[model samples]
Target: MIVITAPTGNIGRPLLSQLLESAPAAGEELRVIVRDPARLPDTARGRVEVITGSHADAKVLDRAFEGADAVFWLVPPDASRPPHDGYSGFTRPAVQAFAAHGVGHVVGVSALGRGTPVADRAGLVTASLAMDDLIASSGVAYRALANPSFFENLLEEADSIRDKSVFTDVVDADRRAPLVAVADIAAVAAGLLLDRSWTGTDSVPVLGPQDLSPNDLARIMTEQLGRPIRYERQPLDELHTTLVGYGLDEEFVQGVVDMKRAKDQGLDAGVVRTPDTASPTTFEQWCAQILAPAVRS
Candidate 1:
């Protein structure tokens, strides 16, 4: 049996879709822990067993993990709490459940910067790494998909791109770093969940095919969308103030600031992309297919 959490999220949705098509052929039964079963794809309805509720809930995890051989674990972002509570605290119950239920393999979504100099101070990434440690201690074979930023993050600026032909970020325009598509992350997760052939407890870096700077993204967006898109660098202080102004917890806001600062300091730059580490989706393809449609809409 295979279990998936947050099956309706960006990464989980695609992962679930891939598993729906492939798991049955692999003799795996599918189950999902979701807050609202209504949010799941209509096709998933008579196919996978549904455990309605938060996966962070001990009771929900108990039922979901029982008889499950593998689990695709993902913690939904919660800006209402501190970083530690949002990641490690949310995962504590599931760690116990994993040991109790004897679930063999677990795949989790996590950020880059595990062993880097900035890792200890990288706030949310630090908490996420701690969560990985908590899970690994459960004796399950765990593989944390260590990822950099996502191309999909640009969707948040779709309106700005459409209206002003601009996008903003905390990083410098010339700072090149790996960026990936969530679909690629989902694909990697699905592959690991299906073939749990090897794993003790380690991270699998899913760096995208190439490193891209904000300026490079702007140039690609301009060409792809047929508009004069430009990159604007936002001050880190301004980002922190803006997030806090939106009523996010102060500590969580700090976490966001720390993560952006660390990224700017090359925390995510430590990983060299190899054929084994690189994922297939390119930023150009994503901008044309995903961002273009969003900007047009």
Candidate 2:
């Protein structure tokens, strides 16, 4: 049996579809834990077993992980909680469930930056790495899909991009890093979860097709959208203030700030692309396909 968590999220949603669509042909049992049963696709409800509840709840995981062979795990972000607590705390219950239920292989959504100079200081990355460690220590065959910044993140600023032709971030406009499509990330996870021939723990960095600076993305958007879209770097203090104003925890806000600073310092540049990590979606392609439709809407 294969179980998936966060089945309604950006990566998890797609991963669920991928698994369900392929499972029939491959003969794998697909089960998912979701807080909202209605959020699941109509095609999937009939095909896979659905366990409704937050995965963080040990009771929920206990039921979902029972007799499961492989599981896809991702700790969804909660801004109100500090990074340490948000990432670690959420995974703790699931870890206990993994052990008690005898789940064998686990695939987790995590970030890249395990070996960079700023690895220790990058807040979200640091927490994600810690998550990987905790899962690996569980003695399950684990593969942390260590991902870079996602191109889909730009959609969060869809209104700003549509109205002002500009978007804001803490990372420098010139900083170059591989931006992945979440589709590729899910694809990797679905592949890993289906086959259980491998064992042991490892990090699989899913870098996108190419590296592009924020300015470079702007240039592409200008051509694709027929508007002069631009990128702006907000001051770290300003970002911190805005986040805190939203009632976010101070430590979590700082972690976000530090993660951005680490990027500006070339933390993401530390990744080396190989065929395994280099996914096929480019920023330009994403802008043309994904961002374009969102802007038009």
Candidate 3:
């Protein structure tokens, strides 16, 4: 049996579908941990076992992990909490649950550029690496799907794009970084979960289609939507203040701002290409296929 947590989320939605499609052919069963089963799409209904639970609920996690041979683990970011403590609180319980359940394998969602000097620059990434290590030591077959930024992040600016003709980020205009589709991340995760042959603390980085600076991304969005869209680089100090005002800890906001600064300084350079591990989706393709229709309506 394969158990997937966060099965209704951006990555988990498609991932659950892929697992359902692949499970029948492989003669496997699937279980999905959802906080609310009724909120799941009709397509996902009756396709797999829906276990209601949060990652932190041990009793619920035990029930979901029961009889599960493999699991796709993901720690959703809690921006409300201190950034350094977010992943830790989420992953520790998961690790404990996995150990108790005797689950055989796990595929985890993680961030890129972990274990580098810039690792600490992104508190979230640093904490994720620690979580990966904890899972590895649990003696379970594990794959850490370290993905770069997701293009879906742009959706946060839908209203701004509609009213102001601009999208903003802390990244520099000319600093290119790999941006992946959550769908591609889901596909790679599904592939890992289905393949029992792969094992042990493997860090799989999904580079997406190619690298693009915010300026390049802005150009693509403008061309795709046939409008004049622009990139507005948010000031780090202002960004930090906004995040803090949003109820995040000051230290957490500072760490996030530091990460943005690291990106501006080209800290994500010298990436390794793993052409076969997984195929990635492009930002323009995602914009055309996913974002454009949503924005048009």
Given candidate 1, what's the lDDT at residue 31?
96
| Per-prediction tally of clashes | 0, 0, 0
What is residue 173's positional error in candidate 1, in angstroms? 0.8
Per-residue accuracy of model 1 over 49-89 as CA lDDT, tens digit each = 99999998999999999999999999999999999999999
Candidate 2 stretches greater than 4 Å from native: none
Tally clashes: model 1: 0
Q: Residue 30 of model 1: what lDDT?
A: 98
Question: Residue by residue across 1-297, what tens digits does model 2's lDDT show?
Answer: 899898889999889889888877888998999888999888786888989899989999989999999999999998888888888889989888889999999999998888889999999889889989999988899999988889999999999999999988887788888889999999999999988788999999999988988899999999999989999989999999998899888998999998888888877777789997899887878888899999989
Task: State the lDDT at 194 in candidate 3.
Answer: 82
**Model 1: runs farther than 4 Å from truth?**
none
Candidate 3 lands at a TM-score of 0.95
Lowest-sum lDDT 10-residue window in model 2:
262-271
Sequence-dependent TM-score of model 2:
0.98
Superposed by TM-score, candidate 3 places the C-alpha of residue 101 at a distance from the truth, in angstroms, of 1.8
lDDT by residue (tens digit), candidate 3, 1-297: 999888889999999888878888998899888889987878777778888878768888889899889999888877767665677666777788888989989999887776567776666666777778888988898999887778898898888887787999988789887778898899988888888897667888887877889899889989998999999999988898898889887766776777677767655654675686435677778889988887777
Candidate 1 TM-score, C-alpha based: 0.99
Distance (Å) between predicted and true CA of 244, model 1? 0.9
* Cα lDDT for residue 198, candidate 3: 74
